[model samples]
Target: MLDPQRTISALRELQRRTGDAQGAQRVAYTAPWHAARGFLTAQLAELPVTVDTDPAGNLWATLPGASDQELWIGGHLDSVPNGGWLDGCLNVFAGLEVLRRLSEQYDGRPPVTVRLVDWADEEGRFGHSLYGSSAVSGHLDPQRAATLTDREGVTMRDALAGIGVDLQHALKAGTQRQKAVAYIELHIEQGPVLERQNLPLGAVLGTCGVERHRVTVTGRAAHAGSTPMDARQDALLVLGRLSQAVYAWTAAHGGVSTIGSVTTTPGIPTSVVETCTFTLDQRHLDPAGLAALWDHAQRDLAQFSADAGCTFAVSPLFQIEPVPFHPALIGACEQAILDVTPQAARLPSGPLHDAAEVARAGIPTVMLFVQSLGGLSHNAAEDTLDAHLDLSVRALDRLAERTITWIRAAERHGARIPAAP
Candidate 1:
């Protein structure tokens, strides 16, 4: 089992050092990623795992198993600007705990090889989540790395240059070894569902798919005080109606939709609104349902534009389908949760994660969520109860043991695992 004290200490150090935006620094490429990477380098030394930087700026810690093949556990170390304490740090430490246990318990000969990866720039602070993980899954283009930049106008190329890794280096890692029988991640629930359910931990029901887009409504800009509302085609007015429709749609659907960012131009609110831009965020567990809502929004956009005598432009922002955890892997996690804790619940992830990238590579993957108090995460206030964290560690141990048992049995028959995918 992972030493709860050690895991807690590791987490504290990561938080104490990095969250401050001082100790470890922001490490956003040319800005502050070094401080972040520096802290990881220091911490992984305790385990003596081989750490390497991939082309896409991923820092990987490999704990060699008895075999060449492996089971990989990963989480990003990057955080949003002034982000939460638990966001990416918890998973990194949790995976480290798994590695620590493997080294101590199995004599470097676990049933399957094990690896712990610390993905860089998963937050897209430099643009793109899973930049590190995506490289491993064979999704990133080496050239695209040069195009990504941070706030200071430093391309990912230049930022990683100081670290001795370029995009060409991060991208060629290859996918043949994506052969892990199963990949798992443990993370704070990032929502209040588990806490509301009063469960310390739970199986992930699924990850929600998100659809984001930019909508521009254009209407004539005229003298604000002179143009009457009944006669004038005001873009801001149309946008207001659009926001109301979005809110109504979210209320009507089982899912949610939001226009988080909106802006109008004229240099003054008192002047007639010429153009308006807004963002729409929609998410749900069902892919078809998400698409239907997306289509619904499109229809609304068209009709609203026509009714308001305005021109509308909708551009795709981000689109991803919901990813369901592997049933078999989830079964192991479910049983492990029950073995380690008294209460367990299942819920969908509201936020995106690396698992979706790995799943796209044809690996059977599952995620486990530890309780986040009040569903609080991504900030200094983000917290998972100590008891919950203990239970979570124990559950990971149980999962590792069960996986070893299955892996060893497979070796007896000259196979790696029962067919997944």
Candidate 2:
């Protein structure tokens, strides 16, 4: 029942509306994002679902069922600057396809309610990522949300109000917790793992725990021409050494660590750098492992910096505990993949997603991944083949169908729902 032609046609229209030479520019709280939201609203106009927006700007289209129990499926529509077309938006539109197909199959109402969502600000361009999902999950810190400012010194609170969302109301929205049984999302692998294995689809095991830090190295500035290599304390050199160490750490260990951005104060060609700052994004599947890695990184990097006559400072940005998918949900997803395709692979996601927040909120959560063409994402060149995308969409539709059956069966027996891991 998954219509590839309809889905692909919708994708073409989205790309035409929101896409540009630089790829998708649908950043949250921006004009393009608002336009894209309007487009989505138009698409849902003919459906039986009731569409509404939360205080945090999350868009929801709810279709009633015979029972009050609900299943939420969604992903963010916002993207990083020059991000790929399919990174976050694929799950959302694909969810719409599932809803459309389900609507055509049922008579008056389906056995279980379904809500398709488009979470806001999963890219975290303002301050923190997963803003909308975090608010929905009741994990948002009011103090933090109240003070977050964007590049132009505009507070997130004002930005939300500009789009008709109140911060206080947003916080309150989490209290109206519907009977959401599970949250499912489909995403591109954004890495080469599935492609290397020649797999079209993979069921996500869980989202990785993350530790983000801003590291600064300070050293005495010296004249580049006058100071000898042994005599000069170069902050840039110290930063280079520390970066290499971090790379080695992740290489030897079984995780991923990245320094995506760097800045140097007094970055003059004729002068030794006085200060250098860089960001660290560390990911691991286990909390214990992530903790150990952080502890060792701080201690070892400090010594490494000191050996180069520089002082090292690390400012913690955020820490997300590892979240594993519920066993029942994982099994359902795996079975759905098998039913749709000849083979399926199991993998853990290194990138954080909105599903992580839903899992934290105690709703069972799982994800599906389509293969990326070359492990590229968050860039204009990021992409996946149409065949791969179509296959993943079909698998997700099958998963949703299976999940409906599971939820209805559980409701029938008055079975106790299992807690999320």
Candidate 3:
């Protein structure tokens, strides 16, 4: 039988082994991350499954069934520096428990194959998130990935070499999905929405599209004490205005935006800023809304810079369109959540996940979200109530069963997997 307590115990054990007072240290390509993976492998030892790591470093544990078509459950084991305990590993351990139950019930053979994937580097310790899943979906560019470096100046190439993962062969990981028909993931909501609504679990609608850019404004530097306010062409002033405008514009467009970083050229407080640079990150579930947000930012930047007698430039850093989950799979998730709780809220994921990459690969995909305490993540303080965690495991198991049924029905009727709505 499926045991939520065992899954919780496993999570606690992993946290005790891999986490410190500072927080979880399972950053990708690190010793702690390897230990976490090893811990998961040990857990799978009691099950009847084949385990292996792909060229891109994604770990797969497969339980063979009568049919070759695969239903995939996945999450990452890697976390950001000082990340929360339940951020990534919860999905893995929960899926592990479900796998145990299925193995015992089916005598290790079910109607279709089930694979649990622990995607490598989903936290992007080297500045590239979804590294493993993207590679498996054929969306990762090896050449560009090789050029990325961490704070220690170690290139992504060298880091992959340390783990015996050849960057050049990473794209071949896509072959692992040859028989995959659908994918599902369980994750912490990492936001305040569910908690604020007094809810325990939510069915994720989809991952939001993102527009990331770096904006730089240049102006003449002058002595702060000498230059009159009217005479000063302060780039910082323009940047500050632009930052406020971004937030206002995003709010008006029903999206979200952040000025995550800022820097000024002048080192001393005595000098008027000559140049300022900042990063703007915008997100929306709708593609048109996202585009409108960016358009507003551009217009505001031009006006603000012109008014300040400064020159401004924008450089695109990254972008991805909104990814909607498969409608049928989403319905399955909602039904599963409803089975465990009185209410099932459907919400878009402002943060990205491996499911988005899988969905983009043309595989049907959906995600379940457990509430996070204090709306926290990527920090030591992030947490969720144990009761909620237990509920999430049960819900995820139900989702798995529903997805299996859906897949079999599709196969029987010769119906193609429905696309995302």
Q: Which candidate is the best by TM-score?
A: 2
The whole-model lDDT of each prediction reads 0.73, 0.84, 0.90
lDDT of 2 by residue, 1-421 (tens): 5585676677668777887998888888898898888888898987899998887789999988887888889988888888888888899889989888888888637788899999989988765778888898998886767787766788888888899888877766685356898789999999999999999999999999999887898998888899999997788887677677887777767688888778897888989999998878889998877887787688877787788888888876667899998788888888888887898899999999999999998988899999998999998898888888888888898889888887877776786364321
| Candidate 2 to native Cα RMSD, angstroms | 2.3
**Each candidate's clash count:** 13, 0, 0
Off by over 4 Å in 1: 21-32, 140-171, 176-178, 419-421
Better of 1 and 2 by lDDT: 2
Model 2 residue 112 CA deviation (Å) reads 1.1
Maximum-lDDT candidate:
3
What does candidate 1's lDDT look like per residue over 56-162, in tens digits?
66667877777655677878777777677667767777777888888888765565677777777777655455676777777776676577666667777776777
Candidate 1 global lDDT? 0.73
Overlapping backbone residue pairs in candidate 1 total 13
| Count of backbone collisions within predicted model 2 | 0
Q: In model 3, what are the clashing residue pairs, if there are any?
A: none
* Candidate 3: stretches off by over 4 Å: 220-233, 266-271, 415-421
TM-score list, all predictions: 0.88, 0.94, 0.93
